[model samples]
Target chain A: MSARPAAIATLLDLPKPYLLFLGDTREPGYAKTAFGLRDWAPELCIGEFALTEDTVSTGLKRLSPAAAYAQGARAVVIGVANYGGVILPSWLDSLVEALASGLDIISGMHSPLSSVPALREAADRHGRRLIDVRKPPASIPVATGARRTGRRLLTVGTDCALGKKYTALSLTREFAARGVDAEFRATGQTGILIAGRGIPMDAVVADFEAGAAELLSPDAAADHWDIIEGQGSLFHPAFAAVSLGLLHGSQPDIVVVCHQPGRTTMSGLPDYPVPSLEDTIDMTLRLGRRTNPSIRCAGISLNTAHLDEAERRQAFDIAERSLGLPAADPMRPGAALDALVDSCLRAN
Target chain B: MSARPAAIATLLDLPKPYLLFLGDTREPGYAKTAFGLRDWAPELCIGEFALTEDTVSTGLKRLSPAAAYAQGARAVVIGVANYGGVILPSWLDSLVEALASGLDIISGMHSPLSSVPALREAADRHGRRLIDVRKPPASIPVATGARRTGRRLLTVGTDCALGKKYTALSLTREFAARGVDAEFRATGQTGILIAGRGIPMDAVVADFEAGAAELLSPDAAADHWDIIEGQGSLFHPAFAAVSLGLLHGSQPDIVVVCHQPGRTTMSGLPDYPVPSLEDTIDMTLRLGRRTNPSIRCAGISLNTAHLDEAERRQAFDIAERSLGLPAADPMRPGAALDALVDSCLRAN
Candidate 1:
C-alpha cells in the first residue's frame, strides 16, 4: 500500500497541456486516446494535431506542434493506437518536428517513441522528453491478498475496447458528484493518460499483474471508492489473464460488467465469440471470489452506441430483466446511468 | 508453432556438464534447482558446491569450481533460489572464482547473473557466457485459442512450489517409457534448467502468458503428448492469473491436480488457506473449458514428502475414494505413480 503514492506520483509527472496527435487514423476507434483526453480531461488538452486532412478529429482546434507549443502545449501525445502498436515510419517526421518545436513527445504505443531514431535524436538535441506510457514502473511487488480498507468497483468487459474505461470514468464522476470519495484508477494506457496515473496492466510481467493491480488500488478509507478501469475480458482468448489478474488484485466489492451488444466476436480474435452477459457476471464473481468472497455484481454497463434510441432502451430493459441488475450506457448519461450508479453505491 | 523450434534452440544453447552452486543455503527447499537437475538429468551434472561446511547437500560429490572444470564441466549453475532470487553479495567472490576457473555461469534467479559487477566483469575478462534462465524469449504472440494437433496433459497445482513441475516431468518420463511420444514442457526456471528449454511463465509479460504457453507446446503429431508444467495455483491470490492463463493456453485434454497434503496456507501468503482438491479440479476444469471445451482432470499428484509412509498411503486412499481420481506421489515411483500416469494417458 505504501508503494501506491510513489507509483501514482511518478505516473502523474507527465508534462501537461498536451497537443493530441491522431496520426493518419481515419477511424475514431483508433483515436481513443485523443477522444479520451478530450472527453475526460479537456482542461489538460490544449488542441489536436494530425498529419492527414481525412483523419478523424477530437473536435479540438487543430494546431501544429510549434503553434501548440506557443499556445502552452507542453507535449505532443500520440493519441492513436494502430495495429501492432508500432509507430509508423510516416509519422516520424511530425514527431521529430514536435521535439524540435520545444514540445515533449508522449506515446502509448507498444513500441517506444525513443526507439525511433529521429524522434530520439531530435528530443535529445532539443532537450525534450519522450514519455512512453506503456512502460510499467520498476519494482512492483507480488499480490499479498490482504484485504484493504476501501471499497472498489471494477468495470470488466465481455471484449476488449468496448467501454470498460468509459464505464469506470463515468462511475467515478457519478460517485464523486454524489459526494462519495471516489478516484479513477486506470489500468491501461488511454485511461492512464486521462487519469494522470495508473499501472499499464498488460505491459507488466505476468508474475506481477495482480501485484501491480494491488498496488494501483491500495488501502483507503472504508467509504472511499476506487473505480478501477479494467483491461481485456474474462472470455477473451488472448487477454483473459490480464483481466483475471486485475480482478483478483483489485478485490473489488462491486463489479460492473461491461459489454458491447452487437459485438459478435472477441476483439482482434475473430475465432472466439463474445461471452453472454450472464456468463460474464457468473464467471467474474466465481473467479473474483478467490480474493473477495463477498464480491457482488453491482450492475451492467452497455456500449450501446451501435443501437438506435429505441433499441438502446429495449436492450437495457432486456438486460435488466435477465440479469436482475440496473443496466445503462454510461456514455449516455440519464436516469439509466443514475440508476446504475445508485446500484453500485448501495450497501450489500 | 514456428516460434517453438527457434525458442527451444536459443534456450537449449546453454553450456552443459555443470557444477551446481548451492550457495550458503541450509534449507533443502532452497536447493530445489540442484536436486531437480540431479533427479531429472543426472548425467548433465558434474558435482555440487556450497559455501558453508554444514549446508544440506544434494548428495552429489562435493567439488570446487576449478576441480569441476578439470572434470569437463563447462558451466557453474547457481542451484539455489534464495528469498529474492538475488546473487547475494556474500556469494560474489565464489561466482567470480567460477568465472576465473574457466566455467560459464548459468543462473535461474530473479536477478540476472550478469547484474553483479564482479560476476559481469569476471565473465567478460574470462570470455565466458552468463546465462539467466528466468528471462523469457522476446516476440511472444497473443494466444489464438485454436486447438492444435497434439494431445496435451498439464499438471496444475493448489499452491506454488508444491510439485507441479515434478508431476509433469514424472508423467512425461512414464509416457516415454511406455513408448508414447511425450515431451516435458517447462514453464518455470527450474523446469527450464532441467528440460534445457522453457518459457519462464512468471517472467513473461502478463498479456503474453497464454501466448507463451501456446508457444511452449505447439502443434505436434496427433499421437504426441506435451506434458506441460504448470505455475502457481488457480486459488492463489497472487498468481492464479498465471495459472489460469497457462491453463487456458495449454488447452490440455487431460489435467493432473498437484497438491501437498499437509499444507495449511498458500506458499507465502499465510492469510489464505489452501484450496481443496475437489475445488481445484472443479475450478480448473470450469475455467479451462474456455479455451478447451473437452478439458478433463486426469488424476491427483501429491507432494507426500512430509508425510510418513502410513500417512501417505492413508491420504492417497482418502483422496482417491473421495474424488474418484487416482492419487500418487510422483517422486516415489511405484504403483500409485503408475496408476496416476495411466489415468493421464487414458482416452478422455
Candidate 2:
C-alpha cells in the first residue's frame, strides 16, 4: 500500500505561511479574515492574494491559485464571499491545480469543498488535505444547565463584525501579559484558524449552539478567565438567535459590549437602527442574567476605527460617560485594558 | 416483484382515530400530548395508553403497542419522556411490533425511532411508515429580516408549561367563534399532532429556529391572524435561547404573556425567581421590538389551575390590575378572549 498522509489535528499548526485567497468576494467576512490575519497574525499569513478573472484590487496583490505553492505558501485558505447557491464551476479547476501542487486547502463556507467529487479526487490523487471549518463536529451534547465553576468573559457586539474576535484576543493577551492564566476561546473560522481550535458557532445546528459553547469553555481552574468570542448581536433580526444562544451558553460572569461608534444602522438592514450603547448594555445585562445572575457589563470594547484621532477620543469619552463603563479600543495603547481586566479579576 | 405501498402525502388526511402512546414515561411532555388531544381534538384520538414491563400507571391506561392495530389505531403516536439516553431496548421491540402490525409510527422525541434498525426493518417489511415529527425539513433558508405583512399573534410564557399552548388554542377558538379566520400555529409536537402540521421549534437547530417560525406563519390576508404557539420562557436558564428565538422569529404584531399564578420560581432553577407580570410584560415588549418594533403585549394568559375557583378569579384580578392588560384563564368563558381579539384587530 502507498504511504498515507497524517490527519491534520489543528489548522493553527498547519504548515502555514498561508496563501490567503480572497476570490472576487468583497463580503465583509472575507475582507475581515484577510485583514485580521495580516494585521494580527502576520507571521502565519505568508502572502495575501486572490485568484479571479475579474481584475479587482481586493486591497491585496493578485496571484493565480496555481502559483500559490511557488510563492512560499504551504496552504491556501479560501475566503469566498458566497456561501449560498452553487460554487462557481469556474473555481474548481484552479482549486484542483492548487491541490496538485501539494498545497493543503481550507475553506470556511457552507458548501463543503470535500463534497465536490472532482475536488476530492484531486486532493486524494496528490495526497493533500482539505479542511472545511464550517462542518460541525459530531456528538456535541445538548447543553445541560450545569453551572460551570470558572470565571468567563464573553465579548458581545452591537452587531456582527464589530471587533468581537479582536477584543477577545486583546483581552486574552492583556491577561496573559499580567501573568494571569487566561484563554481565548474562538467561535468562528477565522478565530479557529488563528487560535488552532474552536467551534464555528453559526455552522452548529440551532439546538446544539449552546452545547458547543458549553463544551468550548470547559471548566478551568478558578481565577482563570476564558475570554470567549461572541457571535451576532441580539438586536440583529437575521442572526439574533445565534447571539442569544452564545450568551446563554457561555454563562459569562463578565460581558464586554463591543460596538463601533460609527455604526448608524443595523448591518444590512437600513430600516433598523442600532440600539444606543446604553440600551445594548442594559439589554445584554438583563438577558445575560437569565443564565448567569451575577453577570455584569464589565467594560466597553469600543471600535472607533472609522473616526479620526480627535473624533475617536470624543466618542470614547462619550461611551465612558454615557454608559458609565471603561471604553477603549483594545488594539490601541492607553486603552481601557486595565479597567476590563481589573473588573473581571475583582468579580472572581 | 412485490407490490409497493402508496405514498403518504399528509397524516392530517390519514384515517383518524390515532392511538396515543405514553410508554410508561410520565414526563410532562407525554401527558400534555395525551391530554391536549383529549381536550381539543378528541375525535382524532381513539385511545390513550402506555406499554411497559414496569407497569406504572403513567397517569393513563395501559395498552400494548403490539395491540394497537386491533384497537382500530391507524397510527401510534409515541411521546416517550426519556429522549436523552439511548432509547431503551424494550422500546424498540414494542415500536417494531407496532410497525409489523401495519400501524404507522409517529414520535416527537430527541431520540428518533427512525434511527433504530429493527424499527426501520419492521416498517419496511410491513409497508408501514415511520414519522419523526422533530426531524426538520430540508433547505430552511436563513431568516432575511424581511418584513412579513400580515397580522400574527404569539403567546409567550413566564415559564414552560405555563399555558402558552392552552392560550394560543383558546385564542384561536375564540377568534373562530367570533367568525374570524384565525389559525393556531403549533411550534411543538403536541400542537403539531393536534393541528396536523407545524414547525417543532425546540427541535429545530438554533440558527434556523427563527426561519421555522417565518415559514410557519406565512403572510396571510390582512384579516387573518396566525396565532403561533410559543416555546420556553425567556427567563428559563435551560431554554431562554429557544424562547428569545421564537419571539424574534414570529415577528408578531400582538403578544400574549402566559403565567401560572402558583409558580413562585422558574421551573427547574429555584434560585431564579420568576419575574412579576409587569416585569415580564415590560421585558418582553422591549425584547420583541428587536424584530418587530410595533409589537404589543395584548394580554396575559394566566394558568391558575392549582388555585381554587375563587383564588383563580382573584389571581386574574391581580394580574389584570398589575399588568394593566386584559388577563384571564383562556379556558374559561368571560375571561379576556374578547379583549385579546380586539387588541389584535385594533393593531391591524
Model 1 residue A320 lDDT score:
92
Task: After the best TM-score superposition of candidate 2, give how far the Cα of residue A262 lies from its true spot, in angstroms.
Answer: 2.9
**Clash-forming residue pairs, model 1:** none
Q: Each model's C-alpha lDDT?
A: 0.87, 0.75
Give each candidate's interface RMSD in Å.
Answer: 5.7, 10.8
Docking quality tier of candidate 1? acceptable
Q: Give one digit per residue, the lDDT tens place, for model 1 in A282-311.
A: 999998998999999999999998899999
TM-score of chain B of 1: 0.86
How far residue A237's Cα lies from its native spot in candidate 2, in Å, is: 1.3
**Lowest-sum lDDT 10-residue window in model 2 chain A:** A2-11
Error of 1 at A238 (Å): 1.7
Supply the DockQ value of model 1: 0.49
lDDT of 1 by residue, B1-348 (tens): 111233331233468888999989899999888988999989889999899998879999899999999999989999987776688888889888998999998888766676677888888899999998888877788888888888999999989988888888889889999999999888887888888778888888989888888888888999999999999988888897898889889999999999999899998888899999988898898888888898999899989998999999999999999999999998899899888888888888
User: TM-scores across all candidates?
Assistant: 0.88, 0.78
Error of 1 at B96 (Å): 6.1
